[model samples]
Target chain A: MDFTYDDEQEALRDAVRGLVGKAYHDYEQRRQAVKEDPGFSEQQWARLAEMGVLGLPFAEEDGGVGAGPTEIGIVCQELGRTIAPEPFLASVVLAGGLVSAAGTPEQRAEVLGALAAGERLLAFAHDEPGRRWGASAEQVTASADGDSWSLTGVKEPVPHGARADLLVVSAALPEGGTGLFLVQPDADGVTREGYATYDGGRAAKVAFDGAAATPLGEAGLDVTASIATVQDITRVMAGNQALGAMQTLLKATTDYLKTRKQFGVTLNTFQALNFRAADMYTSLELTHSLVAWATMVIAAGDPDEVAEAAARASLQVSRGGRHVGQEAIQLHGGIAMTAEYSVGMFVAHLTALDHLLGDGNHQVRVLSTKVADYDALDPLDV
Target chain B: MIEGRELTKEQIVEAQQTLNAAGLAVPHWPEEYGGRGWTDLQRHIWLEELQRAGVPTPLAFNASMIGPVIAHFGTEEQKKEFLPKTANLDIWWSQGFSEPDAGSDLASLRTTAVKDGDDWVVNGQKAWTTLGQFGDWIFTLVRTDPDVKKQAGISMLLIDMTSPGLEVRPVQLIDGSYEVNEVWFDDVRVPADNLVGELNGGWTIAKFLLGNERVGVAPVGSTKRILARAKDLAKETSDGEGGTLLDDPLVRARIVELENELLALELTALRVVAHSADGEPHPASSVLKLKGTELQQAVSELMVDLAGPASVASGAGDASDLAEWARISTPTYLNLRKASIYGGSNEIQRQIISRTILGL
Candidate 1:
């Protein structure tokens, strides 16, 4: 029932907000200078790592700041304010999450420490040429030669693949099961062809032709469960980013409304249009609460709760976040349509986040089946 | 109004038993005075389950508009007679909010009921009275003082639907649904003791009802259900003369865009619900209403677009038994046209935001 963030979480928000304000006040310039660039600047990434921001969510046993989910939520929120080109989720969340979930002691040391130090960038190599997300995997083959495993198959839409030093690959086992393997980008028979995605992120189509790889943990580790953990992080972190993006979009549009004079009056003075802006602000806040709650549940290590929370979070971020982005862009008029404006950065990222894995539509389908029938029982139970 | 979603017989019995168990059966009633002590979220859980299962909110005319007004303003003796039965749906209630002459200009309602010995003889016609066909009783607003300006001197009265000279005729809307009604009260007799609240104060109560009604109308869960149908349907059929509808960039883009919009609104709804202080509604609730309704319509349009010609009819020649979808879309789309107009039109909402929320 308690909804307020603790003091540390508030401080985390203030700190990240300050950093984002200074570094990303104007994202359009950042996007242009870094367009199709390999990755986030090492200096900036190292600075964030040094600050312990990159390890906000990992336990203390690993090389993380040991901050709770709320703290990580704050970092994601600030990163979202700017169209942060850093693969925060792809590396820290997705890859780090897999290692944390299924990695042996040695695997955790090799991958997580570098990630916590921000010395290496990693990408998740799941979602092959399969028809939909979280279904059957068509790519990333795993065949065993003795106890050693070799992988072959292409992983498309690999976020940050071009810059990744480590790639967490989901491999299909010969025994009619699937598991994850830690593959090096420079491994033999592995080729990363780069492309720039619409959301201003560098992605790659990675073809692994019998590439040498090492299993992070036991062969046939639960990929779905591991990915669920990653998805829990992804949903909450994505929600955080969406919250920040919507806030920026709303603020920018609010400024536009105050200044953009038409029919001899500021747009704010017009009830006919100002209502939509007010609505955008309201929706932004609503989505924020849902994401905030999800962060808490994930941090608390409640997977069932996380599942419900993820569904709800995805529901809001993909649904409400999209509305605020659209209205904010539309309210900004022609300026928002052009790439030169920062609002476009927010719009593209919001849309990209909306479609990644699935949009609200897909989330609804996923969320509903989990509970085929709701027995209208006591609300306290939920 | 009975929103076309039907209830199962067992559910109807459950509803009756649940209501009968409560000392005060009014779903909208505040927690005190024998009502269910539920928060807005809990109440919403009830409504969500019902709608997601295609069960309408327990009798809206009673729970939403009338019963709350009576509970708030009724005399003790009036409560004794009306509140209990209204809660139990023992007496089906209908609202007399809009007349043909004052659909949107609700404050300008011309219905009149003059004072009489121990009784008020009402003579007026009300239109778009949802579910007037089943109304055993009605709560109406009458212009008691013509000398006063519009929105002033209106009195709230409780009248038995079967009173002398009262008539209810169903109005079939363009959706081919019999939800609304045209009710004529030709000098009908309503006991003076039946007036729930003070004269000239009905406008205040009516406004409060509008506020309470805002919480559930966004229908986020139901819209989720609709979007689910579209996604399922698109996966089966092609986007007309194409490889597949989902492969059709144009349709896919629209669905994705609408899905995103719907997600944003659902978050907005949760945020608004979370931000609500006490049980009282906020000006921001109006914001949820506006966006939520818009997204509902947009999702409906996508359902139709995804279904294409299949969406137009109730059935398909192939295994395309998208009957639930085909049956729902056109009506749902037509029903959503009022999104901009109801609970104080979106234009009015903007005014509230500009003047009330922003102090501009």
Candidate 2:
């Protein structure tokens, strides 16, 4: 009911923003400079890990912050705003969450400490090359020969898969079901062809080819709940990031409009451009509230509510993401279309968030199916 | 075309019992007077859930326009006499503000009432009275003074629809529906106690009621249903080209644009509803009504366009390429032609925004 962010969450977000603020100025330039190896600075990663951010969602026994999704959302959103070339989303958020959710004590001892101490990075090697983004895992295998098991398939487009120290891979079983297996990145027969992801986070076309792997977590496990949790967290954090970048873009555009004179008047003084800015500003305002609501829904831990809220949040964000980026470029005129301008950077981040997981269309389809169910159940004409 | 209209007697009874059961029948009434004693959000949720459920739009006469006006501005005996029946729908009410001459400029209404005795005998015609033929009563504005400017002299009254010499006749429209009527009060007798608020202050009550009628009139769910139908028609209709009518670049663009607006309007409505507890008549109603009406009209137009030659085919909406699909769209479009005009024209909304929001 209380839609406003609390003091603790706000201060935590401000701290992350401060750190990222100092680290990035020309995000596009930094994005262009980064190669396929390490995405963000190791020193920065160490600073974040040392600040107890990477450990924010883990239990006290796991050498972590013991905070909830709100704190993680802070870091995720801040990183997204800068479009910081980093594995934070991959290592700190997704992989870290999965491991914390299902990993054994021995596994947590090895991975969580390395992650909390900034010694290791992990990737959730779940999404495949051709499937629509869902929890139907078809990436690897788990063959338990009495005592030992190993994985035997490819996990492509694994975010930072080449550089991640650990991989939590989801695989369909030979018998009938799905289980998440943990694999060390340097395992034998694990061949990863690396590439620089467009958003500047590293990804790879990985070929497992019967790689040696360690079995993790219990069997007959439903990762559906966990995967949805991850996606919702990802979505809200992505929205937060988009919020920051959009606000920055808005501020920059507002400033530009005030000073950039045309036809003997400033750009904003013109009705056509003014109306466009007003519309973008309206979208941003709505997206801001919807994202906040999504955070509340995710924090509440109801899957259907999370999906509906996230779908709605994505709908608003999808529109805002495109509108703000495009209008920023449109308002900035030719300089915006050029790579040299900040507007293009916002455009890059926006486009990335737009298509990430599945765009507005995918979420809307999910939402509409449920909405139809709701219609059928209640038969409310509305 | 719309087939026919029928008085929803069962619907009226159901709405009353349901509201009473939910304890939502009373809001502004005192607890001693049977009010819900609920918060603003609770009141809003009640309204929203009812609308979303499509039980029936709460009779504006009983719930919004008259009952609250009476509760706020009526005397105790007046309250004791009217509030209970209004709540129970013992007396169905109709609005008697709009005239044959005045629509949005309600204050300029030429209907005049002169004081004669312990009662006021009224002589005036009220046009576009929705369900007026079925109404048991009405609340009207009559010009009480002539020298004063247009808005100053109007007085509000509760006039019996069945009063002697009152005439109610239907105005058959192009949509083939008789939901509205022109009510003529031929020297009708109404008690002096029927006067609400002060003598010549009906303008305030009319404004209040108009504001009440418009708060969330966007009808998002119904529009969602309509747009869904349009999407189907667009996909189905053949444009006599290599593809369907949907493949027409302009048609697709329009659909996308309208859908985007619907999304925007929805978010806007959510924000308004979310913060609706702040004790204000939200300024965004101007935005919502503006966008909602425009989008509703656009959807109707899109339906007609997608129906194409079937829109004017040999058997439009009858055993043709369109079937019953075109019937709903045609009447719906004709009926929606008033959306922009009724809840204050979208142009009026723009003026409101220009003055209030934009500071123009």
Candidate 3:
């Protein structure tokens, strides 16, 4: 019932904000970091690990701090506020989340221990070239060769795929449903074509031609549901990240409106533009409410509820991100169109996040199918 | 009963007795004045539950608007004379803020009240006096001084609707309903004690009442109910192709979008209510009035669209075989247009958000 964060949560927010803000507070720092190959600061990633952020959502026995969803949300939001090019969402929340959710105790101990210590980077290679965002992997297939499993197929747009030391791949099992498997990027018969995405983030088209792999958990079992659930959780975190970016875009836009002038007056003198900024604020606030609620839903840890909440949050974030991102650039005029400014970069990151998991139309379809099952959605009922 | 527009005197009295006996009639007012001492969240839950159960809300003028003003600024004599009747609906109250010239710019109201010894002679007219036909009394904003600024010269007065030279003429709406009226005051006299607050202080009280009005005007619960009903209607109505209207992708998509928007609005309300402490309004309270009214109007529009051709039967009687819901869809859509118009129009809400919230 309470929306205000507790003292400890507030402290966590301040700590994360200080670290990310210190590193990427200046737009040039972020641009410089994304200009190169890995697309982020390795030193900053290690610092986050040192700060125990990468381990926020895992159990202590699994080499994580075992913090709750709200804490992870805090980190994601801070990262988003700066549009930090770090692969936290790609590596820690999504990839590390898949390993934690479907990995065996041994796998978790080995993989997460290294991940939390910043000794290794991980990427979840679930998206394929032809497949629209779906839980079950189709183009990627895994087969058993005696006691070892080998994966064959292509996973395109695998975020941080080439840079990741370890890959958590989703492949269709020979016996039945989709399963998670661990693969090495440098393994024989595996090739990665890494490129820069429009958002200044890194992605790779990974071709697995009978690449040696190990089952994430029990072999030949359907982890489709688990993958879907983890994706849902990731979707909620993505919402938090989008909220952070939108907040910054809105602030920057408003600040620009106050100071930026044309024809002897500041931009705020125009009611049309200021009104658009007001609408952006409205959209941000509504999205903020839903994102916060979805984080709590994840904290409650119910798969069905989490799935629905993630879709709702995704839908709102998708809509809000567009409104805020587009208007942010429009309100700032030519400066926003320049590569030197930060507003356009925020919009690019927002666009990337909007489609990372699922867009608004995707979410609407998901929700529409189940719209008949309930008369109303009561967030408090969760 | 669900409409709040169709409550009989007996039903209202019974509800007053039942709700007052349970101390639920006016849960947001001061405890000394029959409030239940509930938190803002609790009061929200109380009202939401009432709406969800198809129960008519306690009259807004009594439960939300003037009652709180009285509790905050009323003299002890005023409290003793008015609080109980206000809570129990023994005296129905109507709002008299908007004038023909002062719709959104309410402070520009020309209604004047001049002092004549122990009496204040009131003159001028008030427009859009909602539910004034059933009002036993009306709370008004009258111009008490001519020399000062428009806002500072105003005062709030409680006037008996039965007073001499007071006239209430029903104003027919586009929907053919008479839910609002124009009240003309011709030298009406009010006792000096009838003033709710200090002279030239009515603007502050009006602001307070309007803030309360915005918070309650969302009607999230009732809108949720109507949307749920729309889903049922969508299922029952056929699309002329063997499949139901719900089978149409576009129809279902629109419903889903509306539902999601309502969800966002409702959650924002909860967030605002949770953070609104010590009777101070949340900064995001403006969002509630702006988005809440839009969604409410959207749901009404959805019903009209769902009714399709059947919507034209808005005035049909029992002789027509069309479902009651279908017959009333268009009128409800027309009636709900007032949601964004009254209670501080949406444009004013945007202005507040831009100026006060965003510093635009």
Candidate 4:
């Protein structure tokens, strides 16, 4: 029932805030970092690894810190506050998560150990071209030759795919269901084309033409369920991150209103503009509550409830992000429309996060199918 | 008692007394004053469960509004006289705050209570005294000093509704219900001892009571119940095709969106309750009232849409072939419009957020 962070959680938050805040406090620093090839600061990423944040979710036996989702969510929120151009969500929470969920002990130690040590980058190459977000892989098919498997398909918009050392790809199996595989980015028959995203982040169009791949865990096991669960978890974490960004945008809007003047008075003196800021605050607070609850639901470890909670939180974050983002630009007038300003970039990053797993419409569609399954949604019971 | 308006005064009192007997009617109050001394979360769960069970809550005037103000600011004699009776529903209290010219701007109310030796002669009118027809007493804010600030010149006086020179005239609402009244006082005398707090200090008590009103004003539990019922009704409804209304993507999407919003609100309420044990309402409590009422009205609107043409039969009787839910849908929807209007209008809530929270 408690929503406030614990003393230890607060300490973790302060630590991460200190690190990212120092690096991205000035908007120019984030803009300069995103201009580079990797789209983020390598030193800061290494510092996060040194802080054990990159390994916060994996088991210690798998060469990680073994922290719960709340702690991981804290780091995500901190990164979101500054709109840090890091691949933490793409690399650690998504790709590293897939390995921890579907990979064997040996593979987990190898992939996640290197990832946690900041020696390797992994990207989950699950999203393919001409397909809506789903757990099954239709275009990407896997062929098994004796004990080895090779993948043949195109996985476009593979987040951080070019910078990744290993690709955790999902492919349709010969029998049924989706199978998880690990492919080397420079493996034979693999093509990687990377470009900057609208949010000043990086993603790549990865093509696999009979690229040699290793099974994540068992050779022919169906990891479709695992893929869906990990995606759900990532969706919730993305919500946490968006909550942070919305918080900053709201503050920025309010701070601007109190100082920015037009026709001889500050913007706050205008009820019309101030009320919109109030609504943005409403959106941010609601999103914060939903994200916090969803994170706790994950920490509560109820697999059956995770998907629904994730979709609910994602819908709220999506709507809230758009409301706050657009209002921020509208309230600030012309300045927020500029590329150099951090507010618009924050909005762009929120849009990227919304489309990453599923946007508001997609989530509502998913939820609409089961609208009659329950009489009412009880947050506590979940 | 569906919607609670159909219940007689005796039935309402009996139900509340039954709850009071179990210490469930006023669990939010202090332990010495017939309260269970439950935490805010516990009281919240109690409310949600009561709503889900379709039990009519203790009268808001007695349980949520005036009862709390009395317990917080009343003298020992006043507390000893009214606290038990209020909790047990022995005294049906009505709120006499709003006037014709002072709805949102309540501090501008002209109701005056002049000191007349041991009695206060009260005059002026109070509008929108909901359920005043059943009131045994009324808690009022009246001007005791006309020279100072509009807010500062006010004082609270407890007046017996049966007193001479007092009249209650029912005001018909658009819903065709007699749920509210305009109370007039022409030199009605209230005992000087009936004053709940100090003279010219009613504004502070009014604010305190209003804040408490906002805390539970969301009605999250009952709104959830009605929405759940609406879904069942939608399933039984026709969409002009060979399928039920629930089969329509538009209807389903609408319900899904509302359900998601409700879940967010419920979670927000939980967060506020978790932090509100310190006695000061959480700043985010304003969101509860603003968003809560919007969702409540939205759910009611969904029902009328589900009923479609049948919603026009709001006047249908028991013998009518129209579905019971369909016949009542439009009126229920109309009645719920008051939700956003009361407990401080949604616009006032936005003002609070912009000024108090966002500091805009």
Candidate 5:
């Protein structure tokens, strides 16, 4: 029932804020980091690992700090505030989460251990060329030969795929249902073509031509449900990240309104623009509330409920992100249109996050199907 | 027994007495002042349960607005004289804050109360006095010192509606209802003892009262009730294709989006309530008013849209064989436009967010 973070959570927030904020406080630092290949700072990722953030969501035995969703959400939000291009969500939450969710004890130990130590980077290659944010893989199919497995298909726009040392790939199985497999980027018959995304991040079109693969957990078993659940969890985490970026956009926009002058006075003098900024603040606050609530739903640990909560949160974040993002740039006038300023970058990241899991319309379609199933939605009841 | 209509004064009084007997009338006040000493969450639950049970709430001028002000700033005599009666609706109160020129800028109100011996002669007009016909007394803000700043010269006074030289004239609205009125005072005399707080301190009291007004104005539970009922109504209304309106994809999508937004608003209300402790209001309270009113208006608009052609027959009597809900839909929607307009218009709420919250 309490929304205020406890002292320890507050400390985690301050620690993350200090690290990420220090690295990305100046916009040029993020610009410079994203200007080259890999799209983020390797040293910054190692520092986050040293700070134990990479291990926040895993069990101690599995080489994680075993922190709750709220703590993990804190890290996401702090990273989002700076729009830090660290691939934390892509590597730690998405890829590492898939392994933690469907991986065997041995896999969890080997993968998460290396991940937490910053010794390796992993990316979730679930998104294929034709598939649109679905949990199951259609184009990619896995084949088994005695005690070995190989994957053949193409997964386009795999976030950080080229940079990742390991790839957690979802593929259609011969027996039935979707199964998860692990593949190395440099495995034989695997090719990765890296490119820059609009949001100052890296993605790759990975072609797997009979690439060697190992089953993430049980062989030939359907991990579709597990994949969906992990995606749901990642969706909630993405919401937290969006909240962080929106907060910064609002702060930066408001600051610009106060300082940036036009004609005879500062921008804040115009009621029309201030009113628009006010709407942005409202959007941010509403998104923030839902994000916090959805994170707690994840902390509650019910898979179906987590999925629904994630959709609800994603819907809000999608809508709010657009309202805040577009208005942020529009209110700031020409400066926001350029790469030298931070507001436009925030909008780009928001646009990216909006579609990363599911956009507002997509989430709405998901929710609309079950609209009549409940008499009313009561968040506290659960 | 009735669900969703204005209650007669007797019904309201009886309901108030029933709630007061159970100590549920004013749970947010101090226990010494007839409160239940409930937490904010409990108070929220109380309101939600009341709405779900189809019970008309206790008079807001008493339970929410004036009751708290009296408890916080009233003399012991004022508390003793007002709290018990206010809780039981023995004294139905009406608000007299808005004037023709002072709707949003209320401090600029020209209502004058001149000191004349032990009585204050009041002269001015108040606009948009809601439910004043049922009010036994009116709480007013009057200018006592014209020489000082407009806000600094004001005072709050409790005036007996039966006083001499007072008039109440109903103002017809777009909905063709007389729910609000204009009350004029022609040198109406009031005993100086009726002043609620310090002279020239009414501005602070007005702000406090308005803050309370904004917090409760969300009507989340009531909106949820209406939305749920809308779903049922959608199921009953035919869509010309031999199927119910709810069968349409667009209809269902609209309902789902509204439901989700309402859910978000309700959760935001809960978050605001949970954080508003130790007497400091949460900054998000402004969002509650802004989005709360928007959602309220949205649901009402949806109801009208659902009504479609039947909405034009809003004035149809029961004999028309038209569904009562469809008949009332348009008026309800028109009436709800005031929800955003009153309670410190949504635009004012945005101003609060920008200046107070965003420091813009």
Candidate 6:
């Protein structure tokens, strides 16, 4: 029920902010970082690992810090504030989370240990071409060859797939449901085509031609539900990230409105623009409430509730992100449209986050089917 | 007895008494004044349940508007005189803050109250005096000094509705409801002791009262009830297909989007209430007003749209074959347009956010 972070969480935020903010406070610094191949600073990644952020969500026995959802949310938020192009969300929260969720004891100790130590980067190569956002994979199929398993299909737009040292792949099993597999970058029959994304990040068209893979936890067992739960957790974390991005966009817009002069005065002197900014603030706060609530729901540890909370938070973030992002550009006029400006990149990042898990329409469509199941939503129900 | 019927004033008063007897009428007030000393969240649940169950909430002016202000700012003698009566609905209250020229710029009100020997002579017109016809007393904001700033020169006065030269004239609304009125005072005399707070200090009290108004003004519970009802209406309605209007993807999508927005708003209200547990209303309470009213009006619009052509039959009598809900849909929709306009127009809310919260 409490939304304010405790002192320890505040310290964690300050620490992450200090690190990321120092690295990317200047727009050009971030630009230079994204201009290269790895798409993010390796030193920064190692620094986050050194700070134990990359281990925030895993078990201590698996070489992690074993922090709760709130702490992880704070880290994601700080990273989002700077729009740091690192794969903390894609690697640590998503791919690492899948491994932590479905990996066997031995597997967790090895893969997550290396991930936490910053020895490896991971990607969840689940998304496929012509498919909308979902929990289970379709194009990718897993075949059981007596004692081993291999995956064959394409996982296009696999976030950071080419750069990832390890891949947590979701594939449809020959028998029935989806299963999680661990594939190495150099595994046989693996081809990765990495490219720059709209939001100054990397995704690859990874084609697995019967790629040698090991099961995440139990061999040939369906892990669809685990994958879905992990995705829900990732969605809530993404909401936290979007909340941070919107906060910065709002501040940047307000700062611009105060300094940018036209019509013989600053832009804020016009009530028309001020009112729009006010609406943007309203959007940000409302979305913030939902995102924070969803994070709390995740902490509460009910998968069903987490699923619902994630959808609600994702919807609000999508709508709010669009409003604040678009208005941030409009209020700043043409400057925000330039690549050199931080506001446009923040907007681009917000848009990317919006479409990452599920957009507003997607969330609403999922929600509409169950609208009749309840008379009204009660946030305090938990 | 009041569930489905058009409640008479006496019935409304009796309902408040029923709630007041249970100490549910003014749970936001101090415990000494019949309040339950409930948390904001509990009070929220109380309000939502009342709306969902079709129970008439305590009259806003008596229970929410002036009662809390009086309990907080009234002198011991004033509280002793009015608090019990206000809580029990023995004295129906009406608001007298708005003037024709002071609609949004409320501080510019021209109403004047001059000090007399043992009384104050009040003279001015107050517009938008809601439910004024039933008012046994009126809480007024009047100009007490011409030399000071408009806001600084104002004071709140508790005036008896029967005071000499005081008149209430009903103003029919677009929805054909005689809910609002214009109250005029021609040198009406009020006992000096009837002043609620310090003289020329009403602006602060006015702000406190207005802030209280906006805090609970979102109508989250009622809007939610109406939206749930809209879903039902959509189900019963035929789309000229094998299925009902609920079968329409667009209808369901609209309902879903509105439901999601309402969910967000409800959660926002909870967040606001939680933060306001310290007694001062949270600044983000403005979001509740702005978004709350928009959703309220939006749901009403959805009801009208669901009623379709039958919505035009708002004047239909009991003898008509059209569903009662359909006959009333358009009128309800038209009436709710005032949701955003009243309780400090949504525009004023944006202004509050821009100036106070955002520092824009």
Q: TM-score for all predictions?
A: 0.72, 0.71, 0.98, 0.98, 0.98, 0.97
True contacts kept of each: 0.22, 0.03, 0.58, 0.84, 0.69, 0.61
Ranking by lDDT: 4, 5, 3, 6, 1, 2
Residues A1-382 of candidate 6 have per-residue lDDT tens digits of: 8877899999999999999999999989999999988899999999988988888899999999999999999988988898999999999999999999999999999999999989999999998899999888899999988978899999988889989999999999888899999998898899999999988999999999999999999887888888888999999999989899999999998888888889889888999999999999989988888898899999999999999999989998999899999999998989998999999999999888888888999988888788767766777785
The C-alpha stretches of model 5 lying farther than 4 A from their native spots are: B1-3
Off by over 4 Å in 4: B2-5
After TM-score superposition, the amount by which residue B173's alpha carbon in candidate 2 deviates from its true location, in angstroms, is 3.5
lDDT of 1 by residue, A1-382 (tens): 3456778778878887776566667675567546647755566677788878877767677777677677777788888888677777778877787788878887787678888988877788887765567733556778888887899988888888888898988877777656888888898889999888877777889999999888878875646676776776787788888888888887788778888888898888766567777767667666775687677677667677677667767877887777888897888888888877888778888987876656776776665453323322121233
| Over 4 Å off, model 3 | B2-5, B8-10
For model 3, state the Cα shift of residue B146 in Å. Answer: 0.4
TM-score of 1: 0.72
Candidate closest to the true structure, highest DockQ: 4
Candidate 3 residue lDDT tens string, B1-360:
543245665786787778888888888787878886777778887778887888777878888888889998999999999999999998999999999999999999999999999999999999999889989999999999989999999999999999998999999999898889999999999999999889989999998887675456678898898888889889989988898888888888898888888888888888888788777877777888888889989998998899889889977898999877878888888988998887778777887788888888
* Per-residue lDDT over A190-260 for candidate 3, one digit per residue giving the tens place of the 0 to 100 score: 99999999889999999999999999999888999999988998999999999999999989988898898
TM-score of 5: 0.98
Model 1 / residue A93 / CA error / Å: 1.1
Query: In DockQ, how does model 3 score against the reference complex?
Result: 0.73
In angstroms, give how far residue A350 of model 1 lies from its true place: 3.1
How high is the lDDT of residue B334 in model 6?
88
Pairs with backbone N, CA or C atoms under 3 Å apart (clashes), candidate 6: none
Evaluate model 2: give its TM-score.
0.71
User: Candidate 6 chain B — worst ten consecutive residues by lDDT sum?
Assistant: B1-10
Model 2 chain B poorest ten-residue lDDT run: B1-10
lDDT of 4 by residue, B275-352 (tens): 885678788888999999999999989988888899899787888988888888888889989988887898988999
lDDT of 1 by residue, B71-106 (tens): 788899988887777777778888888888886679
The alpha-carbon deviation from the true structure for residue B277 of candidate 1, after best TM-score superposition, in angstroms, is 1.3
All candidates' lDDT scores?
0.73, 0.71, 0.89, 0.91, 0.90, 0.89
